[model samples]
Target: MAEQRMPLPPLLLDGAEYHADPIRRALSALAGDRAGRFAPGDLAAAMGSDYTMTVTPGRASVPAPADGTGGVYLVESAAPVTLAVTPPHATRDRIDRLVAYVVPAQAGGTPGAWYLAVREGEPAASPVPPAVGAALVLYDLWVHSAASGRPIELSDMRLSGGQQMLAGGTLAGAERPATAPAGTVWTSTTTRQSWAYSGTAWRLLGVQDDTLASHALSGSRAWGPGVNEQAVDNLTFGPGRNGGLIELSAGVVHLSRPGRWALSMQAFSDDGTPGSSKVWLDWPGGPWLTRDLCDTRMRGGGFAGAGVLHQPISWTGVVTSDQALNAITIRGAFTPSTGGNRPSYMVWLYVDYLGR
Candidate 1:
């Protein structure tokens, strides 16, 4: 039953079942069936599978199939040869199942010991491929116009689920394809970045801003605005006093997203009397006010004199979504050291993303 089921040609049974004619017919018939065609198993061999004919470095050949559709090869070569073939024009094509491989030689690095499959003819080369200790396989299954032999499509199931994107060489040396079909996905064997080909070029996925922003302000406004203290008036601000994130008019810092921030402020008692300066922050609906429970000041005044002293105060915390940062505000205040001396201060704010 096994022999009967084996794709042995009737003529081959009379001859040798291992002959090229039988195997070629078997492969053609198998592919033909898979491709919606009929392949005559007895057609006379029109091409030689044995390496009797020498195919040189820059040569090509289209082994004549019994029905001019497809055929097999028993190549004896040192390098891997590129095989290509075109299918007859129809509404569709399905010859992609065709495959190719190199048989390992017991004694490596010798010519005329490997099989190079044939198709639409050649323009491919493999120069002294490194000695493969084990049997290796390579395949070329291009379905082209039966009439013009033009490429229509391709896929690589080995990578990203049959993507038309492919690179040549080892993973370290592989280069991205020059062009790819729409929706084709490629994972760089070199960088391991998953790039999706969007017809124009490869685009990275899940990328976020990796920039850090900070702003610092110092000096004094002759007429103080209000304490809790400075009102960031505008949407955009000079990096000196209010980084663009601070709103000068409403004293609010509107951030598009929640982030970790470092808020610090300093006040100096420059006059010959003791004075105090303070800073604090509040969200529209926050977990807590950013200041000591008893004291809401960023800087406590020092003993005023020729030795002017500046006090520094700071706070660190995570801004959460519920406490929409856009609704938050920062304020500062200054108290006179003596009779009519004005208070002076400085502040710095830094925001950074933590990927949360």
Candidate 2:
């Protein structure tokens, strides 16, 4: 007789063979028809053995079956089992089942407030909320003109507090230093003579003659309104009977005494003739004689004298026939010489008051 062989229990075959294959596979088979489920021992074995299983709740294991079919069955007197399986890659459709949900609060009761923070070895987090009542700051982004290739263009422009604004037509309050216009010209006149404020110090522009003789001439002589009076006198002497004699005297005699004088003369031969004798005298007399009178035969043999004199002479007391005398002579004589025979003689005698 063959030993009676009870039919192998289905659990004893493939489905019930818990110790035959990996614990995760047997438990996964037993969690029948659920989206995700897990057993404790299976979860620990999967994590410890492979380190690739995901043991998070509601992540990878299926739920327990309601009909007790194809689920992890705890046999009588057997420790409960846990099974772990690799979770599927996260998908938009399964995100709610796999991931936790977190809702963020609004900032200042307004939307659109957002920030980001990055950390090492971890996922980045959102930034903190901004202060209340704060204004939004913005940067100045310059935009150039496409046609002109410039940032700005205008006839007049202005700036205030780092911001530029356009001016309407005119600049009313703008203050600037005075400036000369283009092509501006200035003119003035200058003179060579010295000038004074009262117009009195300016001299004549051309040559000026200030001499007394030049002032006395009849031409257009410019004269200042000041007094211009001049006087001169002259007297002269020569060799006469008494060795030396006062030959000629001429001057501008004033009433009491003359102030201005000038005279000239020449003499030749011992005879006193009109053309043979010439004489002149000025105040402060002397033998102011020129030319050789010793050789009387030469046509030019005569004494010549010419000079200018300024002296004071008396002219009030007595008069004489000789015009050279200033006054009457108390004692004097005139001896006339014979032609080419005797020596000539000239006498000048007069007396007058020597006035101041």
| Count of clashes in candidate 2 | 32
Model 2 Cα shift for residue 92 (angstroms):
99
- What is candidate 2's CA lDDT for residue 184? 20
TM-score to native of every candidate shown = 0.31, 0.11
Q: What is the C-alpha RMSD of each candidate to the true structure, in Å?
A: 20.4, 55.8
lDDT of 1 by residue, 1-356 (tens): 45456554465366555545455556534333221111111111121232111222211111232333344322323332334334334433333322223332332455223333333322222212122222212222344434544553333221222212222212222466766554455655533444455556554432222322444443333333233245433323435433222223443454434456555555444444344555444455654554231123333234445435555556566766455334645444556444344454343434433443
Give the lowest summed-lDDT range of ten residues in model 2: 212-221
Give per-residue lDDT, candidate 2, residue 41: 22
lDDT, candidate 2, 199-263, per-residue tens: 11111122111121110100011112231211112322222221111222242221112222222
Please name the candidate that would achieve the greatest lDDT relative to the true structure: 1
- The true-versus-predicted C-alpha distance at residue 240 of model 1, in Å, is 11
Return the number of clashes found in candidate 1: 18
